[model samples]
Target: MLVDKVAEILAETAAEVIEPRFRALADGDVSEKAPGELVTVADREAELIIAERLRGLLPVPVVGEEAVSADPSLVKAVCSEPAVWLVDPLDGTGNFVAGRPEYAVMAALIKDGETVAAWIWQPTTRLGYTAELGGGAWRNGERLRRAPAGGGPAALRGVVLSRFMPPDLRTAVDARTGGIGTLAPGSRCSGVEYPRVAEGDQDFTLFWRTLPWDHAPGSLLVTEAGGVSARLDGDPYRVGRDVEGLLVAADEESWQQVRRELGLRPVDLA
Candidate 1:
């Protein structure tokens, strides 16, 4: 009941709040949170809108990326809360600033240390994805199902690999897969890869690091869409803890072959 409403509001509010900001990108005020990291006024404004609307739904705490950077302990504390809203407003600020269409407003509902619901709204196209625990995933009100497109090691579409990934791992990935297409959209901050995999835009999404707010929403989205997400060691994802490394593949065959090539164990299988 409440969960259904949460998914609906997230899809609605995100479109409403993010539209104006998208129009103002050229003239938007941009600032750096650190060297090479940026945030726009839209980020703050969008986050404010999201947080306020979420607060109306419940008294649960919100841990936003911009808000938590000043004091990361807030995230640690929120993980202890029975319910918390995790948000990454304007994820892919670089892409947003460069006038690309990959940016999004990301949010997830975490309860008892597990993500139960998530929404990823791509403001430009008005495409929104939502998922609830044990409930199926949806894109624009239609249920999502994964399609196995990439055929074996050679026919994969774009591989969403981060630049922050280790060189050795990258080498291993390249060696096992011949002439694989690589797509580095940068800043996996908002779970961009998760939905991309679900929609068959990308065959695989790899992460050498994990952020709770960033990954939680997309994790459920990907898995709910019939894909599989696992830690580098191949364990089922459990946020509020470090993944050591993470990899999300479109199917079990992809997961098994990729993990074996990297000499990494899937967390839960073995």
Candidate 2:
């Protein structure tokens, strides 16, 4: 199957390109793409390797995060492509560069702007997650049961989008999340947190950057595992959508709970 083949490539890419460079980055191996947005040698090399090899696994366009950063047009290209593969060669470059162990390789197959299949591989843990639209989610090949709905903001536990939030909104979110369950000490890796959420160890996660390579796979996995993912305005998430950011919950009930806590109605958010 293509997922199996892609998984092999992901494993190989991590073994050869990503793992070796973790905490071993030489001088000049890191540069900022934009302020606070760091890209490392591992990110570039792994993404290049993934782009080269993953493209062979399928005929569709491989819209890798690093590749699209170089050529912004590819983001638009993905929307029109009949099908596309979005790859995040090295998620959590910050943690990896900092010698933290919260990173992974993530990929998703998007057909007509919807995520149909997804995979995430954490090299350090050698743990893997995969999901198929409506086929359910799995961890290391074990089928996952949906996590139950959380209590409320106070019970919500996971990441939030403070980095991408506006100053006032950031303060508000900080206060709101502070009132809730503790924010999971982020590995700064969505690949890490997404699986944590799927396993029901974490509650909800919010993100202001809706990067396809970042959210596509995790979104499907969270939803398939019995969580809910949608924009703040209470709309279902769609790949390549130009929405501001996203909210993921233990279930639809929590999603709306967060939305209400934020004082956003669907008419305003969506």
TM-score of 1: 0.85
lDDT of 2 by residue, 97-208 (tens): 8998989999999888889999999999999899999999988889987767657777877777668766776786667654665676566788987888788877778888
lDDT, each prediction: 0.73, 0.83
RMSD of 2: 1.7
- Where model 2 places Cα greater than 4 Å from the true spot, the runs are 266-270
The sequence of per-residue lDDT tens digits that candidate 1 reaches over residues 1-270 is: 665666666566656655565546655388788898888877777777778878888878889888887677888855689999998887778887776777877888888998888888776677788998889888888999997655764555545453655676557565654444454454444556788888887777767667787788888998898888888766778778764567787887777666664455543222
Q: Which candidate wins on lDDT?
A: 2
RMSD list, candidates in order: 3.4, 1.7
